[model samples]
Structures are given as C-alpha cells and as structure tokens.
Target: MKPMKTSYFPIIALSAVIVVIIMAGLLLSDAALVVDFASKKQAPSLSHPFGTDAYGRDVLLRTLSGLSKSLLLGIAASVVSGILALVMGIIAGTAPKWVDNAINFIIDAIMSIPHLVLLILISFCLGKGLFGVVMGIICTHWTSLARVIRGEVLQLKEQQYIKIAQKLGQSPWTIAKTHLLPHIFPQFIVGIVLLFPHAILHESAITFLGFGLPPESPTIGIMLAESMDYVLSKLWWLFLPGVCLVAVVIVFDRLGKQLKARFDYDNMRG
Candidate 1:
C-alpha cells in the first residue's frame, strides 16, 4: 500500500480566509463608520448579521475593520522588531566582549519589565496614537529574537569553515553576509512570524486600556473597550469584535508554528 500523503489543505484554506478578511476589511473600513440612528442597538438578523451598535454602525463591518487594522499593525511592528533583532544580534555576536555584554544587559533589562506595563508607558509617553502603538510594540518585541540570532551567529562563528574563511583573508562583513546571514535566515523568518501574535495582542491590550489608539479609531481594542458598557445590557454583538480578535491571534500563532515545523523538517532533510 502507498504511504499517506501529507495534506496542506488546512493551511491553504486558513491563509486564504485571512487574505480575504484583510482585503475586505481594508476596502470597507470607511463604510463601517457610517452611523444610522434608526437602526441603533440592533440584534443579529438578516439585515445585519453581526447587528448594529449604539450609533447604528454595523458590528460586522466594524469588527472586520478592526481586525484588518490590527493585523496590519502586527505585520509592521513584527517586521521592524525582527530587523532590529537581526542587527543587534549580529553585533552582539561579532563585536567585542564589552559590546556583547552591553547588548545582553539591555536585553535582560527590557525582558525584566512587565511587557504590558512597558508597552503602556511607552505608548503613553509617545502621546497615544498609531505612531505610539507601533513604536511601543517595536521597542519591546525585539529582545527575544535578538538573543536567538546572537546565539546562532556565535555558534556559526566557531565552525571550522568560518575559521578557514577568516584565515584566508575574508572580511567579517563578507563572511557574515555569505554564511551567518544565510544560516540564520530560517530562524529570522520564524521569529518574525511568531512575533505577529504578540504584537497584535499587545497592541490590543494597550489600546483597550486607553493608551494606544485614539477612541475614535475603529480598532479591535477600542471596540472591545466600548463594548464594556453594553456588556451588562446583554448586547452580545458588541463583544463580537473581541472574539474575532482572539480568532485572528490564534490563527497567526498556528501559522507561525506551522512555518517553524516546516522549516525544521527542511533543515533536518538538508
């Protein structure tokens, strides 16, 4: 009998759904803001599947808009954080002992603080807007990935091939570019993917606490925050945005793990 084939249908389907949500949300976000006093405080029905808010704004549209914004924010923050990590890690691994120690100290200092507290403080100090939220996430999210990359680079540097290249007059930059960077590329990719959920969750938390985006902005955090008042009133649709946010976070987390597993399998084969 033939061996069973591995199925990627789940991954492909999830990815497609994510793309559709993002695109639809981006395009319809403005429409989600439209308020209709006549339809205010609606329950889920044929006219509005997710119902309407106090301002008669469609809950589904608002949720979609918020999710898309959060997802985009996560992508931006994660990529920037990952790049920062890559640079810092490379420097820590290759530079003098003092420099390495300094980087490690900085990483330890940042990690020691509570993530939510640091994020709130940074966002508050930055004046609490889109810029503040993005900067806050970027600043706080790079330490872990930096440590990983630093360890990988340090290990590669001790390899005999790297020593041979160094003895043959190869420049440090050249060696890093050709060898270290390539070797660590997989880890870098995986780290950035993993950072997505953290960035999204942190962004939501800060915003929900009234320290990230402005209240007027249609973000998942803001939606969740506003839904608090209606919770006691039993307005279930109002909290649907929070549910969607959690779903997106879970999806991204799973995606990252899948990518890591695939990379590990490929590495083992290689």
Candidate 2:
C-alpha cells in the first residue's frame, strides 16, 4: 500500500526543520553563552529577551542551546532504542520457542522496574555524562517498542505469504529480511515517532535530578536543575527555561501523534 498524502506534511516538515533550526542556533550562539557581571539577574527585558542568568548570559540564547542539546539527546536515544527494538523483536518473533521465552523474560524483567529509578541507576553507574545518559535511555526505552514490533512480526508470521515462503524452502533469515521487515516498517516508524516525547521527557527528568549530563552542560535538564537555586529569588530564569522545555516537549508530542496518524496502515491504504 502506498502512503496516503495527509495534512500533516507541514507539521512533519516543521518538526524536522526544528532540529535543523536548533543545530543552527547552537552553532550561531557560541558567543551568547558568555557571562557578563553587569547584567546579572535581569528580568525579561527587550535587550535581553529571556532575561539574564546569574552569570548575566542571555537566557534566550542559553535556552535555545539547551533545547538543541535536549533534541540531540532525544534523537540519539530514540533511534538507538528503536534499532534495538527492531532487532530484538524480529529475533523473538521468528526464533524458536526457547529463544522467544528468553527474550520475553528479559523484557518482562526490564519493564518491571520503575522507569526513572532504572534510568538514574544506569546513568549513575555509567558516570552520568552524555554517553551515560544516552546509554541509560537506550537501554531502558527499547522494551515496549520491542514488544510492539514482536507482536507485529508474530501477526505477520501468520500471513499466507510467510507460510508459503517457509514451505517453499526459504530460509528464516531470508524471509525475515525480504518479507517480514517490509511488512513491519510502518509499525517501526510509528513506534520510533512515539518514542521521542518520552525520550525527551525522561532525559530532562534524569538530568534535572542530577543523574544525567554534567552541571556545566547546557542542556534543558541541567538548566532546569540549576534553576532551583534561584527560582525563589529570580523567577524569570526558571520560568523561561521551564516554559521552553514544556513547549518543546509539546511540539514533539504533537509531531509524534501526527506522524503516527500519517503512517497508520489503514490511513496509508486509504
């Protein structure tokens, strides 16, 4: 079935372009992170759009940089987790009974743990840098997506073509590579799209809790975490970064839903 054209194209394009805009903003705002003692703790004035942080850097520039870092982290975690899900799912769905049981057991074990606790432990265990945070998200986030993909492949396994291919002496690997994969591509895409908001939110949460990237990092999580220090004294610093984080997450949430709708199998067939 062909993908049906939908009204979501603009929003989807906007979502994609957002990453580019963030990247460009980060590149262009290198000088903006510089601190000035004279303008410390200014409110949201015209000269300093998002006001000034304690060190007197423009909050707007820092916010944009932080958002870009969050976006980057979200994309990294989602894509890596998605790929792990795809592989594990295919293996579980197509492999033998014991193999399926083993994979299922692991998935069950991972999902049984509290998500944030697991993320924090993993991040802390790995020393809580960029690599550690990414690894933690990647490790924890794949289980649900893997289950979805496994169910999809299991259903596809029952289809006539799959049975016919098996009977005709096609190897399992060949059938999986040529037939099963294409059939599940839509679900894979939807799963990854839906993973973004969760990834971003978790990244921020873990970071805000001081178990993610370093305090010196200019990420949304770190920004929010630092905001607690002066939140009572200077609300603008907290308000601006916090609001931008919410806005970014909301945009990604809407974008994910829109993409899922656009890629829905029924919608594509229509």
TM-score of each: 0.94, 0.92
Model 1 residue 262 distance off true place after TM-score fit, in angstroms: 0.9
**Runs of candidate 1 exceeding 4 Å displacement:** 1-15
Instruction: For model 1, state the Cα shift of residue 169 in Å.
Output: 1.4
- Candidate 2 C-alpha error for residue 3, in Å: 14
Candidate 2 structure quality by residue, lDDT tens digits, 124-194:
99998888889999999999999999998999999999999999999998999999888788778777877
Q: What TM-score number comes out for model 1?
A: 0.94
Clashing pairs in 1: none
Candidate 2 global CA lDDT score:
0.83
TM-score of 2: 0.92
lDDT of each: 0.91, 0.83
Write model 1 residue lDDT over 27-126, tens digit each, in one string. 9989999999999999999999999999999999998888888888998999999999999999999999999999999999999999999999998998
Superposition error at 130 for model 1 (Å): 0.6
> Which portions of model 2 show Cα errors greater than 4 Å?
1-5, 265-270
- Cα RMSD of all models vs. native, in order, equals 2.5, 2.6
